[model samples]
Target chain A: MLTTPIPDAAETRSNATFDAILWALSRPGLPRNLPEPGEAALIEALLDRECAAYAGDPLLIPVLAQSGARLVDLSEADHVFFGRLLDAEYLRACRVGSDLYPDDGATLVIRARIGQGATVRLTGPGVNGVVELQLDGLPAGFWQERARLIRYPMGFDLLFLDGDRLIGLPRSTKVEVL
Target chain B: MTLASLTKPWAPMSYGFLDASAKRELRRKMVKAVCVPGCQMPYASREVPMARGWGTGGLQVSLTLINPQTCVKVIDQGADDSVNAASIRRFLSRVSGAPVTLDTLQADLIQSRHRIPEEILREDQVLVLQVPNPEPLRSVQPNMSIARQMHGDADYGRMWLQLYEQIVRSGRVMQGASYPSMVNGRHVMTPSPIPRWDVPKLHMAKHLTILSAGREKRIFAVPPYCRVEPLVFDDVPYRVEDHAGLTCSRSGAKGFFMNEVPQDDGTSAFELSDSEYGVKSIRRAEGDPVDLGDTWYTNGELTK
Candidate 1:
């Protein structure tokens, strides 16, 4: 009889991080707790040598490098990490992917304060109805720019990080700045 | 980075039978699948010990998600004790040491083939479905490239025409299992080969559902509270199987999906399709204290 394999510490952390990420994405606008703070857990759970990633924060470069993902330009990257947003130029450059293959769209992880800034209403598939969320530290007109750039089913997905808290906004969500 | 920092101590096998890289890839794909709701995302379906078409897709997802803390439940066509379900459950437990449960209420992750549980799944639970064919456009258009374009364009007119032809020929929609449903009002996906009775349980439900096809190398999702509308004409209504009124001969349960068994008298007898639910019903009838969770169907009708 084969003995059951046990998960090491790293495996446990990655699994928990992914569980949180999946939950946050499945129910948009809801806040979920990650295994740890910041994007380290995200990189550990998602990035590998097969991925192309772009890091906006210099401090995250070493961590990304350890993951063995090819560092590339913002447009070419499938996963892009923005530590803090001072401008909205990167949103325009982000890959929305083509209609034929929307999975090619980039997953953008940004640092922001949840529950404390501009109140916006979200209505989408995951949302039960209209859910209002307060997000801070984003550039001015972020929602408008996102709406302009996205064509349904072909837009990039967003993950906002605040310490250990996470909030996901998929392309299907309609964000109305209130 | 030094070698010691880059690698860990060697083990006989990975925790869940898949290497770290495979799990990472699946995690990325799953993120994208959840983001897009019904859009099919292609991924590298790594080989497991099982055959391609025998719930390998669901197995892969379950393996990626399983840990020692997770409670797992596996079902094949609603029966928890079938050869396929039993072997898969035993293999999962053996590989990961995750606790196995026959009760749906206790399961954190439920892997099913051709049926969803009759009990209402909580918000924290995840449902992984095994799909043989992920594409709903295959029957209408054989060319995959054209089919992809049709999906991109949301050109489901051909799908409607096929249903129209079916109704014209049979006086009702002839597509029995794997009924095509619109997800998030954007993409049409085959919710595996589940009977029509199980499809509504997915629509706007309180759990996350992921459908994967290992042979097809496709994965899709239906997030909680997402719209899942079955294709139907304006004049015609979507219909489930006529098993709502049937009672289980063995468990004495009524008003739920059932399996029809042929009797010696040329008549058909019914038994509950969800084996665990039936067991609970039987135990309750025997005066045992069994706590049955609120089911999706009550009195042969979908409530909430």
Candidate 2:
């Protein structure tokens, strides 16, 4: 994990969320273009930051070498799934949807080699028809799994990358792999 | 400005899509808002791959107005504790690195939903309200050409008549949130979803007001000293709404705009007031950023 003084709290805040959304819609399967190269430091910082709309407190950060946030009190909560996803859940079953709140399920963040390849046919609001992006050897059930969450704006918010290229597909999108 | 060179940081944001150019684009819209004095210009809005029901428009406004020097306050359902309010507060704090607070008074800009703050705002303050649907004639008629004509000529006789019809048909206005208004006697527009209760506050507000919608992809504004009046008949004037005796548990204020928070047993609680920078001002020692509270937030209500 990298370390530096939290800049001045004032420096990091910006209004680019809409811009990001526009980028996702316009580009279709292409990853939202980063105006600059994605630095390892920036992603790490975002992971540590938990949006207030989500349930958490001054959520603590754990730097067990896999640096990110963790819910402190999850005994009565769904700690197992989050722990499995982030901390140590094995990459066994390509679990697409959870049992409870199946409609509003979790997004699987795979830190793997994903590509805007030709295996998948993607079309939805942002695309002018079918746009294509490919990933080799992901959790086998990834796309079939996401199909479980495709009702509307009630599913996972996906962020994928191979090494440099990154993309986000919110539930409003339709992902069809041909 | 090749990426290989130009190492000065903060020049380009590494995460999310909005570049400084994007923020600059929004700044252009804001200038028109200032120059025309209460015109709701429709601008192209980008969807930030979030829930459509979310506050994308407010997010855009805050992004444009915020800078290294600005402090921000965000509220949802008229309370700082509301879920969406907290999320946006943390969001803006992340993007701007400008310190954010639950205290309404300390902010240079305040982003709100459902209600304006119980505290007053100043001329310098910019209040960005999130709008879901902007077209006042959306339900009245679907013709874009017709709606544009209606706004261009300020020919709201049809809108006025619809309310009149409501009074004639049912003894009430027949509409609730997403109420319509006339901006500076020109733009007949919808003032987002801030219950009819908060509509009057926009009239001649000292600070500039901006509105945005991410789902509908629109942005609008009300300039300082601009007029924002609701539809009403001469004999039956528009009346202010009261929240069945609503009050803020923290501030002890009553009948401000409020929201219902679902309690554990499926009952609900009332939140009638936006956060007050008043308490935070007292909490912090007289020196730090908290001192910014002394000037605004208590610019107090715009009472006749």
Candidate 3:
């Protein structure tokens, strides 16, 4: 006979956080609820010593430091946390990885208001059909910048955070302003 | 920062059988795999309680994804009661306190070896397949570096040539399993070693599939609503095993994949490959309450 192990608080939290992230990514443009509010739960679930992180927001520096991730510039980082964008320069500077190894592309985490701003239509893999979404609080021409910088099989993935809600837009997704 | 902030309390074991860092790394790779939709992603194949080749890759992914609330189902060669399936299910339950089920409809996470369940997987569900080999170009190109270059270039002429040679040699395609497929019209991937009959179930499927090879240290994914087309010439169409119209000897279930059992009389008896489906059929025939979800195939034919 064997006894079942009970999950601790940290384990439960990370699990929930990952579930939220996975669900959000699997169904792009759909807002999924995170385990707890803000990016702390995400950092706890995803970051570790093996990661090279870059935080555009100074407030996230301590949290990234606590995860034992080596903080570096946007080009060298595998994960980039840009709290809020007033310019689209970060998208241009982000690593798109190479054609040989597309997995090396950086995962960009940005803060934006969901269901509030410019209406965009998303279509590609992981989407059942065309999904319409409204996202605000980014610099002008952000979508164009992203579209211009990303190349198929060699582009970064984006996760938009708004309080406890988040949405994922992979580079393969075609974003059209409608 | 103090050292105490970086460290946490010690425990006998990690939450889901894997440590936090391993899970994190898997999570990162999974994200990339899903984004690319069938492109192989490299990862550190961490040690688990099981052997490297015996569904350990699938086990690791299941462990990283499992939670107390997740209802897991494990199957080996389409049967849930096999030794491999039973052991992996028990181990998963013992480690994470997640409920184990033999029913495909009730399972939230399905870890399978060599076979996909007969029932249709919903969008909310995930299927993790154990991959013996992740590279589809291995047969054509022996050198891995050149193979990687081929994949990067989307040059699948050699794959077509291999199929062509098989057709020229044999009357039909000799590939019984691990058929090469084009996913999302971008990358060619081997959807594990599933039989030709099961490969059609992955085309524009609603569920997400993650195929990992532990020994090979590679992982790939097929996201929901992605196209997975098996390569075949226009003149020679891809064909599945002729198992349709054959009824299960015991359960009377017809038009599903079957396992041929040899008898002493030199005759073969057929049994339903999906054991749970057979059990459900038996129960339904015995006037017991049972729910059978929609399957991928209908009367031995794929609807889509």
Candidate 4:
């Protein structure tokens, strides 16, 4: 009989983090708990040498460097970490990829306050009929900018981080500000 | 950074049998796959212990998502005890400390080849399907680049034309498996050669499904509550296989998918494709206390 392999601390954390991420994305507008608070778990679970990441906060530069990912401009980055999105203009430069390769679109991670902001309605593939959420800490006209920039099958995916809780807004989801 | 800070202490093997980088890559790809339902995303297919064509793709996804707490269930063509399914199940248990179960309702993660479970999967459960060919446009357009362009433009004229030709030639849609289905009303994806009977189970399913092709180096997903409509003309409605009325010879289970076994007497004997379900039925008939979950198809009709 073979003995089962034990997962180390890092392994356990990454696995749990990914499970939360997958669950949150599969059910858009639904919040899920991460293993620990912050984007460190997300970086450890998702970033590597194959990624081109752009961090808005300078403090995350060393961490991104340690992941062996090249630091590129917002437009060129496949993964964009906007610690606290202060300007809606930055959304214009995020990569939406092309219709041929929608996967090339950037994954945007931003800090926000969940359940305490403007009420928005979500309707799409993952949603059952309609889902309502409250999100804050983003710049004004954020949803309008997002609506203007995104095209069907060609848009970036967003993850809102609030302490240890996270909510996903995939490209396929249609958000209506209420 | 110092060398010690850059690397950790070496171990006998990496957890889950995949390196950290490979797992990270797969994680990124999976995020993108779920973001855009039914869109095939290319990834770096890594090497595993199994052969490339035989469930390697599904194995990689399973390894990436698996942890010690995850209860895994693997199946091949709806049988849990087949050679391929048994080997994969044993391998998963050996590598990770995850418990293995034959019950569909008890599984947290299921890796299957060419068949979805008969039981209705809950929203928490995930289904990883092994896809030999990810492209639904491969038959109509052999060239991959043109196919990509066609998918980008939502140009599926050739696909409809192919179905039309098949109907004219055979007087019925001859596509037995891997029936082309439109997902999210935008992209047409081949649901991995699962029998026509199994395709309807994916429509608005509560479970999340990830279809990966290792040899083809592609990964796609179908999020919960997503649309998956099979291609068919309005006049000629979509039809499933005619195995609804067939009864299993040994277990007496009926109204589910079955496998036809040829006999020397020139007749065919039918057996339940889902071996575990068959076993449960036989045990229940024997007066054993058995708990069977509600299935996706009730009386050979899709209930949910």
Candidate 5:
């Protein structure tokens, strides 16, 4: 019999964080509780030397650096973290990737009030049928801008963070402002 | 920062046999793959101890997701006792000390090559399929660059034309395995060379299915509740192998996928393809307690 190796602190935290993120993305619009609030835990679980990241939030810069991800501009970065979205125009600059390599599309993590804002309906792969979600904090015309930017199989994914809660909206999901 | 703070204690080997950085890279790509749901995503397929094409992609995924609490099952061409499946199952348990099971019902993670289990998977279980070739358009379009453009344009006219040509030349669709199916009504993905019977099980399945090709350096996913419609023409319906009427000579089990064995009398005998299921059936026949989970096919027909 082989002896079992115990997971360390870092491994435990990363595993839990990834579980939350995976479940959140698999079931879009449903909130999953992260091990810790905010993007720091997310960075630790996903980023490494192989990744190029962009963090608009100054507080997260050191955390991204610690993970050894190169800080690059929003267009080149695969993972972009905006502490709080200010202007809707920033969505235009985010890379939608090519139809060939849709994975190049950025994963945008932004702070938002998940339950109390503009209501939208989600219908796509992960969704059972139509799921209604309310999100606040994004600027006016945010959903419209997002719809305009994404061309199916070539658009950025969004993860709304509210303290310990996270909701994922993949490029496959069609968002309708209701 | 002090040097002592930067450096840490050394271990004989990393847990699960992969370095932390490799796991993180795979985790990132997995999230992206699941997000797109049938869109092929490229990743830096890291080298494992095994050969690149010999189930390394599925092994890496299983390693990354495994913990001491996970129950893992591995199968090659429907048999749990095959050399490839046995080695992978042992390797997984040896590295992470995760419990290993031959029963599909008890498994939390299943790594398979060329076949999905006959039993219906639960919502909590995950299925990892080792893919030899991930590109469904490779046969029609050899150049990957042009194929990428076709996928981008959603130009599947040639694929349909090819299928139509096969029907015109032959009496029916000649393509047997790795059947190209549309996912979420958008991307057409190769379902990893599983038999026609196994393809329908993925349509709106309860378990998450990840198809990874280590040699090709691609990863894709089919999340639970996603649609996976097999590409077919209007008049001609998709057909599975005619194995439902055959019975396993050894276990006396019938109505599942069977393996044809040649007999000396110029006839053929059939045996259960899913070796573990066959064993469970034998055990139950002997009056031993066995709990057979619900199967995807009921008496040779897919259950609605």
Candidate 6:
């Protein structure tokens, strides 16, 4: 399903509820395109490694290959989350198939190690100003991988994280790459 | 619509506050259910403000999918008076102000417990089973890794052997509720204590069948038009409880799902603990067991 970037999900249901919501609500005048929070949980999800997918993010090659996580490049992955905002902790593998047999192929859970706002601010989609988040010690193809997953209106989304906060930029969110 | 009109009665109405993440999560799993046939989606269960066993999972789904346009029915043990069912129905009716149905014929979304209703469900209706435990593997084996691998590889030969062994020891298959089955030759799931009779209904069912276990914290589905077969062998097939001549006392119905009843006698007499309604019907007509055409149960007396 294609979108216009103003996702209502992450705005209300970010994992780390306290800081993420506080930060998003904190900026009344700023564009509300900030990342969600809680990296620890996202990381735990990935470590579970029940599924792994390249929803459209090619830059995931370095991170995925390094982690020995297989690639399930489902072009039709419904709920896409692409951005440097991955928590890598709370993230568990995404369910790819039916419920009876939960996707054991490798579920993809998102975690944020670093985010965009440390040096840059990401604002678009549901943003009022700038969403704060960043990632550090990323793979060589981080930006390229992040860009690769962007198939506007059809690709997944991203939750770029910086310490405790992150921005949710779905594929249709129209990132300026600024 | 003015603010007064919007808050006129109850319900969040159209454009519910489910946002999108929760919907996406639910929808993602839902779509996968349609795609892969009958697999359980281990979703990121969102904690509803409601406590456990409160149908939060079902409420969340209803909030996400149903708006002003939907009519919902929530039943427990085929009755609307059940507090859990009523609470859930009230939540949806108040939040979405959708109509509630006590009759099986009037529901658009039927959230059920224990029974599938004697009435046939229509295609327009979406049946959601309130599951306390989604995994059939939980009963036989506790390890999830093994269960996951078992489901992935369809290693349910053991489940069948376990039941068959019970039949050997006793005269019948000793399974009561949460009978396990293979949905589309994959994904071993609990057909949710809806009776072995309901088990057959799941096979090639017309409407979408979604099972949510909030306390167990997992959601699974069986898509429409998929084949769900109870595991059996060429020699021994799926056996429904043929309690010979059992019936419910109040309803005068036999060969139905009967709940246990403790008799209030001065001296404790351990007899068949079926509901009183079950006994009346079975006693009236003297209903006989439906032998598996080929006599699957041959060891004991048929009427005992």
Per-residue lDDT tens digits of candidate 6, residues A1-178? 2212221332223222422322222221122223333443233223223334453345544444433335554433323334443343212233233322433322222434443322334443233345444445444444455455432212333444445444333322233333
What tens-digit string does per-residue lDDT give for candidate 2 at B166-189?
989999887787678876455677
Query: Per-residue alpha-carbon lDDT of model 5 for B1-304, expressed as tens digits?
Result: 4567555577777888888998998888998899778888888888898999999999988988888888999999999999999999999999888899999999999999999999999977889999999999999999988988898888899899889999999979999999999998888999999988899999988888999999999999998889999899999999999988989999998899998999999999999999999999999999999999899887888885
Docking class of predicted structure 2: incorrect
Candidate 2: deviation at residue B256, Å? 2.7
Worst 10 residues of 4 chain B by lDDT: B295-304
Tell me the interface RMSD of every candidate, in Å: 0.6, 16.7, 1.1, 1.1, 1.5, 16.8
Q: What is the Å distance of residue B50 in model 2 from its true position?
A: 2.9
Name the lDDT value of residue B231 in candidate 5. 95
User: Which stretches of model 2 miss by more than 4 angstroms?
Assistant: A1-178, B1-17, B47-49, B244-251, B259-271, B275-302
TM-score for all predictions?
0.99, 0.55, 0.98, 0.98, 0.95, 0.54
Instruction: Tell the DockQ for candidate 6.
Output: 0.03
Which should have the higher lDDT, number 3 or number 6?
A: 3
- Cα miss at A93, model 2 (Å)? 68
What is the two-chain DockQ of model 3? 0.75
Residues B136-251 of candidate 3 have per-residue lDDT tens digits of 99999989889998999999999999998988899789989999999988999999999999998999899999999998999999988888999998989989999988899999
Predictions: Cα RMSD each: 0.8, 19.4, 1.1, 1.0, 1.9, 17.0
Each model's lDDT comes to: 0.94, 0.54, 0.91, 0.93, 0.90, 0.51
List native contact recovery per candidate, as a fraction of 1: 0.94, 0.02, 0.69, 0.94, 0.68, 0.03
Q: What's the distance in Å from true for residue A18, model 5?
A: 1.6
Residue-pair clashes per prediction, in order, are 0, 27, 0, 1, 1, 87
Candidate 1 chain A, which ten residues in sequence have the lowest lDDT sum? Answer: A82-91
lDDT digits (tens) for residues B18-85 of candidate 6: 54445545554543344344456667667765787766666665665554446787877655667877
- TM-score order, best first, reads 1, 4, 3, 5, 2, 6
Q: Is 3 or 4 the stronger prediction by DockQ?
A: 4
lDDT of 4 by residue, B1-304 (tens): 8888789887877888888999999999999999988889999999999899999999999999999989999999999999999999999888888999999989999999999988889999999999999999999999999999999999999999999999999999999999999999998999998999999999989999999999999999999999999999999999999988999998998899999999999999999998889999999999999988898788888787
Best model number under TM-score: 1
